[model samples]
Target chain A: MASPIQENLVSKNAEYASKFTKGDLALPPAKHYLVLTCMDARIDPAAAFGIDLGDAHVIRNAGGSARDALRSIIISQQLLGTKEIILIKHTGCGMLTFSNEDAHGLVKKNLGPSAAAEIATLDFLPIKNLDDAVKGDVEYLKRSAAVPEDVIISGWVYEVETGKVRRIV
Target chain B: MASPIQENLVSKNAEYASKFTKGDLALPPAKHYLVLTCMDARIDPAAAFGIDLGDAHVIRNAGGSARDALRSIIISQQLLGTKEIILIKHTGCGMLTFSNEDAHGLVKKNLGPSAAAEIATLDFLPIKNLDDAVKGDVEYLKRSAAVPEDVIISGWVYEVETGKVRRIV
Candidate 1:
């Protein structure tokens, strides 16, 4: 049986597909850039970031961890032609609330020891100071040999409390 | 000096944060579920799928690949408390337009031989057939022992053409 959410997705998508006309946008984003943001439900990247239909790639992950998102970032830049990156981590981020140990312990608590064992090497990428974290991610990208030095990289803190984004680096 | 995009982000975010007041919502998503979708600018996951603030975590990647999103999904389910997964891959996704070879070649062309060597092992997670890809991701999640057996996993196609989402599994 399809869940209510799934059913709603179908109907809502039907309504949306009916009027959609931009079926010809190129595979690579036209703007030649990408934004890495948290998957926070409160922030709408398209509306908030002024990204158009074929503007830029938006990569979201928990805490918007640049390290965790590096795989996708490489694909976006190296394979897809994006030349710039805007990494955004937000305030009140769940990542700000836990440490690696807390996350590992929680995994054991919620999914049992085997689950914990499975993710024994996992880096939860928790945040201590949001500003430092954002700056650090930009530095990580800059220092990364895989990421070309020519690629423009900057980091920001998107405040969930007020919806304001402040550039950190 | 901040770039124009960075300045715009700050300004636009200020406009949004001024009216934003959903700061008191619970930390753990209310419905204990998460939606994985593409970060296509055209699709608004919150408005399109009826996902209210704090309802569910939204994990997005290039193709909404379950394999790529597994880390966040684990965190959402095991650490946060989400018990269900709604994985939605969209029509006309960039993932559908390339193969691993093409991706590797693009990387070599765009970022040079060193970059190509860096990502020689990357999967790129391209999609040959969208339907099969969606179904395969659901199966991947179901078979993963790290993901609890009881977790509700389903896949769907979010048609960017008309904005309709149809369940595949």
Candidate 2:
């Protein structure tokens, strides 16, 4: 039996595909930029950030961690020609509510010691301050040699409370 | 002075926030699911996958790589109560067009030796066969100790040309 989510995806995608066009868009983003944001459900990068289809790449992960996004960002910039990055972390993020130890403990409790051991060395990249987290990510990208010096990178805080995004750095 | 992207984000966000209302959604995804998809510019997870705000966590990386997404997935499933994972890769994915060495070479060419050294050992997680990639991600999650045995996992492919998704595993 297909799950409800799976069913919904099929039906919704059918609707979207029926109206789909622009199948000839190129591999590289048309606008030469990417947005790195959290995977938080509340923030839809395309609608919330004004990105149109084929315009930009969107790299999202927990806390919108730039460190975790390094590989993708490098590919986006070096190979595919994205020249700018807009990295946005958000308010009331799950990352802000826990520490690495807390995450380790949760895995230990939920999936046992083997699972805990699997993630023992992992850094959850939790943040205590939203503004500082955004600024820190911007600085990390700026200083990283993998990220070219000329690529414009800015950071922002998305207010999940209000569907608004404010620049942080 | 704001860049065009920055200025556009501020103005566009103001329009979104002007009518924003769902401020009471909880941190845990309301539907207890997460969608892992590529950061491809043409794929919009929310619109394409039928995810509503607060419905599910959406994790995107270069290839919708389960390995790259492991930490975030663990946090989502273990700490935040997401019970299902839908991992989706896509047609015309940038990952489909390169090897790890190709990525490394590009980094060296574009950002020089120091930048290359920084990501010398990094795996860009490029995909060779799209079906195998999706199946591999599904199998990886299914077998991972960090992802609980009871968690439902499925894989799919999003056709950039058609705006359609078809099940893979």
Deviation in angstroms for A116 in model 1? 3.0
TM-score of model 2's chain A: 0.98
Q: Tell me the TM-score for chain B of model 2.
A: 0.98
Model 1 agreement with the true structure over A1-169: per-residue lDDT tens digits: 8767666666766665667777667667788888998876666676667666777888888888887777778778766788889998888878888788988888788778877888799887888998998988899889776798888888888766666777788
Kindly report which residue stretches of model 2 are placed more than 4 angstroms away from their true locations once superposed: none
**Per model, how many backbone clashes are there?**
8, 0
DockQ of each: 0.55, 0.84
Candidate 2 residue lDDT tens string, B1-169: 8999888899888888898898888889999999999988888888888899999999999999999999999989877899999999999988989899888998888778998898888988888999999998899888899899989999999999888899988
lDDT of each: 0.80, 0.90
Per prediction, the TM-score for chain B is 0.96, 0.98
Q: How many Å off is the CA of A82 in candidate 1?
A: 2.0
True contacts kept of 1: 0.57
Q: After superposition, how far is residue A71 of candidate 1 from its true place, in Å?
A: 2.3
In the order shown, the candidates' Cα RMSDs to the true structure are 2.2, 0.9
